[model samples]
Target chain A: MANPLEATVLVLGEQSEIFLGLLKKHFSTIYQLAHIENKEEFLKDNGAEIIAVATSNNVGMSKEMIDALPKLQIIASFGVGYDSIDVDYAKQRGIQVTNTPNVLNDCVADTAMMLTYAVARQLIQANTYVKKGQWTSSFPLTTSLSKKVCGILGMGNIGEAIAKRAEAAGMEIIYHNRTQKNHVDYQYIATLEELAKQADFLILALPSTGETQHIINANILDKMKPSAYLINIARGSVVDEKALVESLKNRQIAGAGLDVFETEPCTESPLFEMENVVLTPHYASGTHETRLAMAELVCENLIHFFNKEPLVTPL
Target chain B: MANPLEATVLVLGEQSEIFLGLLKKHFSTIYQLAHIENKEEFLKDNGAEIIAVATSNNVGMSKEMIDALPKLQIIASFGVGYDSIDVDYAKQRGIQVTNTPNVLNDCVADTAMMLTYAVARQLIQANTYVKKGQWTSSFPLTTSLSKKVCGILGMGNIGEAIAKRAEAAGMEIIYHNRTQKNHVDYQYIATLEELAKQADFLILALPSTGETQHIINANILDKMKPSAYLINIARGSVVDEKALVESLKNRQIAGAGLDVFETEPCTESPLFEMENVVLTPHYASGTHETRLAMAELVCENLIHFFNKEPLVTPL
Candidate 1:
């Protein structure tokens, strides 16, 4: 067992202060990668002493970085998605990997439902209409979610949570997963094309992997009804941004509510100008409550690993 | 019985073409008040022949207007709320009154839930942040609706519908109505003050009437938790707008989601400047599906009354 007083932890990139504070309280020696200048020199001096690498989904552990830290035992990630991390390399190196998952499912699901309503009802445009003093005339009527088909692309924990809310709002839920699960009652479409064709709102909730990358490309977008809306709370890699832009321009689909983009910190895109789309800064699970809970989970996973107990949420 | 071909129907103001067409199909002598140049001359020429008044909640038939048409036997309103119409006088003269209710409950409730999530999640500001190229910096974390208290002011059809959606989002429901409802399983509070103090989201879902006017005034506003949000999808008369603006300015309440204003077509207000508040033009039931359904209900009520059947939804 690694002693809490001696085992060093290296935190990569930016994280919430609460997470940093929790690490500080538990470990005696902590190094933040962001604060370290001249990374080569610093790692040469201190890398071998580091036992755990704390990171976020955005600042994932690369194979090169993993090779640099010779004594690294674990990689504790701060988000549910670990696609950015080279998980295969970590597994080959016999290093434990953990992520904060179930803690954030509700908030992420809430975001998916929020975007569904926001796009379907044109809430952002409605707010703009009122703020710009355009209430003298009636705003154009938008579509309603009730009795509409909500086709989910993934049926994981987050997808199920979203389905519950959509069902409560009088929306019918249908989904297309890699394979159908036995627990849920929602009808499963075997093909993604059929799901897109039948959906009034096509929501992407699957993980981003090599097989899933750019899955919702031109072919799938073409299959969707012109009135259908696309909602993506999943990773940005699942969509082809250029194709989505063209789809919106051509009115191939009604609109989109996107939290993630193909290239983020995506400050400039044609989507910014479109009135039909609602864009957020990749903010699914970006709530104080959920983030804090996630931070706590990340810290707990690290604490459990150091204590030689079973990892709370290990990959 | 009034002959469908001979009985005159006076449509008070501008309505959808679908409504006008529906009326035209059943009645040959249709007079649109907006098309008539001189109301006095038009009333003198055709008022006695008018056996029914077709109007909307916004352009309601007043006591004087009801008196103008001596033969008026029914006033079929196009919305659920008949507060603007002089119902007492209509009843005194044995004139039946009907409104399109139940049909709009789902859409209006969807609006309430959308605003609740929008306000709590800071969705509009987040969109603006991303659009303005501010995603380079992190958008601030916002509150989550899950595990929070949702205090509803009225437990009517719309309120119940909102409650169902809120509950599905992992929120606990507590409500304050004139009297406790019989069928609901949610906790009922006896006083509005307790509900305000306990709620993380205080939703106003009651109607606007003599007793309900200005119910959410400065006193109730002050009672709300500073972290709480106000969602008004009900009539604006139910809330004291001046007090609400003051509360928002002072941050007495975190923010508000307003679908209606005290005096609407409210082009000017202090709320337009507040980032925390989300303003939507009185659009709770403003979806194409619900509007058309309401219009159809209006026509059906008129048809049922003309045929000497019971009204579908009477005030």
Candidate 2:
């Protein structure tokens, strides 16, 4: 007794619990690829019926998977980053792609600010010191973050948010971007190496692309001040992870505050061994409120696409 | 024959190594009170010659010690807070009391902001989770600090600095002060209880006074929203420790970010076991730059007092 107009959407990998319920509430048919006993048989049977794919950037679209879905018309991604998606391939196939954006800016900014302050204040080490009963003597003095020059690499929404917070905390802001963003007064550096050298705290909020790959490489790191710290809330591909580990080891940079890793879940790395750096499991926009907002946006984007309206945030 | 201008200053307790060096550099003669192997014998012989006393709040000027130093003209305290000093008794005896202030505001404000963000994002637990290799799974979503209402309890220089920083981070400003100040844009809450009720984060930046002691008591804590947090950087006596412990245990308030405690060298406490609060060993201004500035101020205060000039920061 299913409606003939009800098209099945293949969910690639496990979606969030919130998203599952929401997806069911809005869509009549659901096909979770991970739960299928035999993917080849299930796809062979239901491939023609599948008109859309709902997935996160974590469980991305692949070329072979795309070929399996003969009737697939759209891909709705949960996260803002679309680096994992083969956009060119999707475009050639005329597969429309949509992503959730802007809804998670506040929480993502909070995360960036959190990491910046956490690394600078040595909160991780200080907290451990207090809990381990080692506060018997006076705690050692750490460097001050106030009044330092906060150099933002990408002057996007998240970077502007970080700058606003850093400014409130008495830090001066300078940045390096592709082109001068109009209607903003923050100083801009011409090159990445110069920006790295001058920044007291260098933060990356750039999107990932082929040209932007390994942007924070050995040369840029070598140019950075020994006292400087780096914060990455953007994609992991932006940084040269091997070079970063070496710089952190040699104290070429004072420390790092990272949310994304070159490879996640960074189960094993030299970063895990260092006390100077803070590692987060790529959850910068991981708050319940932001996630809910993002999930809602994803659902809405899918709905809007099916209704043949302009997408809320087209990728 | 002793030179009147070259005052013999009594150094009480174990002073900071930096302060000890600075003290000796500015003053011609120094007497180490703690190191005087025979205290009574030494006092009997040299007490009358002690023209000034240099001590921290920890080694406060006891009434008996003040009586012993008959020639003491000034008390140069190393830290800003003069709560430990018997200021009235010193005033009665025509003795000057000077403390270092303003020099520590930037660092203190930094500490307050650090705690606010640390508690909001659960930085302490996050750090521990990553270090213990438990980040194989995603970290749970914590609260966002951006756009929250930051209600400052005291609007002094340190509080103002905190406001400026919090404002830049997109937090709305509100405050509860004894009286309304001129030329400030933040909304004023008339009563402390109401302020606590409205705040997402209630920060204590007021000085410790007889009236201000236990200002954040059980009754005031009862008025706070369940989602709100308390940040104490002012002094421990400002909050009722028992009430705070109970509130934290019951989740009456979300959490606390504490840098000051009711007692120094806190060997034991139930708070040590709680994961919701972040604690520091009362080192809000514990940065090299700020400490050095404070030390220099202490030396300058002593030098000014001996030179018969007006006390720089008289208590």
Q: RMSD in angstroms, candidate 1?
A: 2.2
Mind giving the per-residue lDDT tens digits that candidate 1 earns over A1-315? 343545578999987887787778777788998998899999999888888989999889899999999988999999999999999999999999999998888889889999999998899989988988888878888889999999999999998999999999999999999999889999999999999999999999999999999999999999999999999999999999899999999999999999999888899999999989999998898898898888878878888888899999999
Task: Please give the clash total of every predicted structure, in order.
Answer: 0, 1
- Residue A241 error for model 2, in Å? 2.2
Q: Tell me the deviation in Å of residue A218 in model 2.
A: 2.7
Residue A161 of model 2: what lDDT? 82
Model 1 misses residue A52 by how many Å? 1.2
Error of 2 at B125 (Å): 2.2
Model 1 clash pairs are none
lDDT of 1 at B81: 92
Tens digits of per-residue lDDT for model 1 on B73-165?
Answer: 999999999998999999999999999988999999999999999999999999999887889977888888999999999999999999999
Candidate 1 chain A, poorest ten consecutive residues by summed lDDT: A1-10
